[model samples]
Target: MPYYMFQWKYKNEAVKALVQTPQDRAAELRKVVQAFGGRLHEFFFAFGDYDGVSIVEFPNNERCAACATTLTGAGANDLFRTTVLLTGDEAKAALAMANATNPDYAPPTGYTHHS
Candidate 1:
């Protein structure tokens, strides 16, 4: 499974709706995520740049994208973004792969540069 980090800011209409009738948004999100074969690990209400953030896991990128886009299709949020996340071990493995394949890759040195 692949993990994703999402941050979102609600539009004024969305804020009004939630305030008018506060509900468990996480539970609602879980329903949608489960339909897409994904799981919500954490959802938090935050301050500053983003109003909220969440971590989710899906079988793959396609499923993750589908779920995320569908959830935001209602025009409730003003700003929304989803980003892929890698575990420490996975990052280490990527570094090792880059090292192993370094020999086959070369940078262009045709242009002159002034120091």
Candidate 2:
């Protein structure tokens, strides 16, 4: 499964709704994620440009996107962005295989040939 970081900012109307009732949105969001084959690992309400940040895990990017769409439809604010996250082990594996020293490989522009 892949992890994703979701950031959302509330529209004025959405803010009004939350201001009227500030509790349980995090819990509600977890339910939404679960419904879409994703799991909400962490959620935080912020005091900055974005209203909240959530870390979610899904079997694939499609499922992650579905979760985001569902949140939007459930009256979350607009302009949502999702960033895919690689676990430490996944990153390490990629790093190890990045350049396996294939003699026939040609480096892309500005990249130095590996010795």
Candidate 3:
């Protein structure tokens, strides 16, 4: 499964609705994501630019996209930014590959000049 980190900022109307029905919101989201074959891991209220952040797991990117699209279609119009998280091992592998770059590289112009 792939893990996703989503930060969401609710629209004014959705915020008002959520304020009036806070308890059911999580349950509703869980049900919807489950229907799309994704699992909602964490949902938290925040005190910054975004209203909440949710961590989710899905079989693939398509299922994750479906969940995001569903949220938008429900008239909530919540603005969301999602990032797919890679495991630590994957990150390490990528870093190692990147460090295997050309060893004969010469410094570019002005490299010897100090600011």
Worst 10 residues of 3 by lDDT: 70-79
**Which residue pairs come into collision in candidate 1?**
none
Q: Is candidate 1 or 3 superior in lDDT?
A: 1
C-alpha root-mean-square deviation, each candidate: 2.8, 3.9, 3.6
The pairs that clash in candidate 2 are none
What lDDT does model 2 reach? 0.85
Strongest candidate by TM-score: 1
Error of 2 at 24 (Å): 0.9
Question: After superposition, which runs of candidate 3 have C-alpha atoms over 4 Å from their true positions?
Answer: 100-115
Off by over 4 Å in 1: 103-115
Best by lDDT: 1
- Tens-place lDDT per residue, model 1, 22-91, is 9898998888889999999999988999988999999999999898899789688899999999999999
Name the regions of candidate 2 deviating beyond 4 angstroms.
101-115
Whole-model Cα lDDT of every candidate shown, in order: 0.90, 0.85, 0.83
Query: How does candidate 1 score on lDDT?
Result: 0.90
Ranking by lDDT: 1, 2, 3
Write candidate 3's Cα lDDT for 1-115 as tens digits. Answer: 9899878888998888778876666777789889989999988888898888888899999999988888877766557888999899989988897788746767897678668
Model 2 reaches what TM-score against the true structure? 0.81
Pick the winner on lDDT between candidates 1 and 2. Answer: 1
